[model samples]
Target: MNLQKFSLEQLASFVQGKAVGQTEMQLDGLASLTQADAHKLAFVNADKYLDQANQSKAGALIVTEELRAHITSQQNFIVVENPYLAFAILTHVFEKKHTAQGIEATAQIHASAIISDTAYIGHYAVIGEHCVVGDETVIQSHCHIDDGVEIGKQCFIDSHVVLTGHCKLGNRVRIHANTVIGGEGFGFAPYKGKWHRIAQLGSVLIGNDVRIGSNCSIDRGALDDTIIEDGVILDNLVQIAHNVKVGANTAMAAKCGVAGSTTIGKNCIFAGAVGVVGHINIADNVTVTGMSMVTKSISEAGSYSSGTPMLESLHWKRAAVRFKQLADAPLTQMLKRLDHMQAQIESLESTFKLRK
Candidate 1:
């Protein structure tokens, strides 16, 4: 736990919220409404959690203006436009900065590399030739920064990270542990029924404020650069293939994969397990639901979902049979057949009337 203490007024000011109650009290930390102690601050973003907020033992609570009046609590409250956002802003105040000091003796830095005076290089970290590490950049232990890599100011390269082959990271980028950036793109050419390797010539360019989660793989380009624009956040185990251009502020959930040469527009949200094929383009502000597969270009911006909803065992078995029948003859073909059957029945009725 952080030993630092923040006054109620100070916390409210930091989040640009209004302190509606007592301001003399101090808070040591933050927690959820249900788990907060008397010295901790908490937040309630919705009406469903109001019960927890009323019962909370927190020193102070951040609440929205709409929910503030509904709460029947005597606890101190900080009213903000968005309580969740305010909570996010205050989280940084209590976060512990990395304690690793100056460049360690065990670090192996190339003579051609340029490291900032304010940078921290941890034990066994490797800095390759011609690499540039900017001010306040922290390359943690076992990190391998390969040749020609450039990392901008205040970038955090976590433990076991591999940044290689002309990769460039902009300022304030945070790559978590075990993430591999600028790896070789999977480019292959087939000739005479065998596979041949294609030399990857381009690099990866990551913009400022990008956060890549752990175990993520971002491949270098085969010819054109793979670009991840500013403010993009990638969840763990995401795969970004070569020559792909991800626009600014795009957020992808865990296990999302964008295949090579795809261009995704700005502010797109891809939920968990979303898979996008190569050579496609997605428009801005697109929201892909979880477990969705994007096989073609998304020309319009909107929400998309695929696959069947969860069902019980017996119901799923019956639906599965119908799904197979529909696959054999889709909706259009089935409708055409229905029209033909109706026409035949009307002709038979007319013939019977003529015979009478």
Candidate 2:
């Protein structure tokens, strides 16, 4: 018998679902429709996957009400308004729980730092001066919490992560490994043919429930604080530069780079490798397609894309020439040419009418 097995009623309550037919059936874990066994639970979020659900040998399924009728065979499933969301919620139930309490020996803690008794500081993790670590927060192995930093309750800072320059994080924040918050921004001024470095004076302020992925960099601001609002999720290898204010609940995919001083609005989705230029504003509810470049401000909420699609080598070479042609013709020149063509068409129409 699987140690992690869950009864149908027990799993239904976790997602506020209605269990049907097999209330006594036990599911050991969650799996995809194509791979689930009789002891595993599966989900069908749409009608297209109904065939997969029908053939699956799973003990039960999680599905929406509308798709239930599409199954050819009798199925014991949990009915929910959103099967995908229920799947996401149930994933935590099967996740491996790591429980740790009390600071480990060989960890360095400054006397001025205030750490809650319930917090866990793992082996060799460094807690710097005047830092406040809240209750039930876990600072894993070799992590560094520098001077004047504050992390709120239930926050998890993973191994080898760095929180420096007095940065402050709100409750329930999760910072993955190899991530560096409050690093210096790329700020330099040209003086006598040499670049003079400008010190980053402000730290980063991350709000509650923010999840930062591994190997990501969130830079400190040049003068004002870099603000990441509540519920923003950044994928791995993403870069947030100086003085940027990322609005609430925005999701940035991997390799997306936002330049300095730009303000991103709430609920915007940046697909993978999308590059946003500095000093521009992106409106709320905007979705930029993958590999697109955002150079101007987005005022209206809509989907936007840039760059040409992939082509064969020779065809791309010809397309590149056409792009160069448009680039050589400035916007003002194009507008003037359009006006001239319109006048010529009107003149030709007038001449034809007189001749007729």
Candidate 3:
């Protein structure tokens, strides 16, 4: 029997789903409905994509209850509560597992540091004094784990990543290459016509299953710890400023910046290059679109966007001119124009009354 090929019955049992058609048909891999082959499985999540799913050439389809009516008799399918989530589970099952074991001889480890026997410390990696590295954790090459840091089990710290100043990370945390945690925040005070730097006295607290991408900077707080709650995913070049409390399961895309002291609630999604101002509270389940500038606190859960949409140069120039004129237009002149129009209407009404 082929290791990759599984019967539709076995697939449904694996995903804990209900089979709609012939369960004896075999499947090899997963693919998009538009590109799926006879051996692959395709999934439909939205109502708009139901027609495409029904017309797909895949041997098997995974769909929600809303899409069951659209499927034709020729299709072999599985009905699940959430097709997209079920597909996500399948991706994990198909993922290649890499297990790294044993510390490299080239690593610079302090005698006072505590490292698990099962952990893998890569070449040129630095483990500072009093630091704790948990079991099965892989610290990749050139990583710097500073003094008093605590990293839990099964965590993956990628190459050149820096965890400074007693930072803490829970189990299964993943930090990609060149990401810096516990760097000093941008805090300054005016003193004698010069700026005085405020000491960054706190570290970063990253909860379980948090994955931070490459080149991202999470600054150390001025006083309290900069906390990233469980399941927070930060994309590449993302800037999470000091004293920020990112609630659980919030995902931020590439180049998104959250200013200092902001409290972002759970399940919030920030698209690429979105900016959130300091001292603001963003409610749960809020989604900010790409390149949006959030200048204030959001009190409700909804999609929020800012910045003007892209327009043609000529049309934008004309609109810009009109926008500038609106500010220059006098209130008295607007009231006068309204009064004159009302007078004209009244005169027209009198003329109609005379004609009648």
TM-score to true structure, per model: 0.93, 0.93, 0.84
lDDT of each: 0.93, 0.93, 0.91
Q: lDDT by residue for model 1 over 281-319, one digit each (tens)?
A: 999999999999999999999999987889999999999
* Worst lDDT 10-window in candidate 3: 91-100
Residue 25 CA error for candidate 1 (Å)? 0.9
TM-score of candidate 1 relative to the true fold? 0.93
lDDT per residue for candidate 2 within 1-356, as digits (tens), equals 33688899999999999998889888889999889888999999987888888898888989888888787664688999999999999999998766878989989999999999999999999999999999999999999999999999999999999998789999999999999999999999999999999999999999999999999999989999999999999999999999999999999999999999999999999999999999999899999999999999999999999988999999999999887777675866998999999999999999999999
Q: Please tell me which model should have the higher TM-score, number 2 or number 3.
A: 2
lDDT score of model 2? 0.93
Q: Tell me how far the alpha carbon of residue 248 in candidate 3 is from the true structure, in angstroms, after superposition.
A: 1.8
TM-score of 2: 0.93
lDDT at 153 for candidate 2? 96
lDDT of 3 by residue, 251-337 (tens): 999999999999999999999999999999999999999999999999999999998788999999998988788777596589889
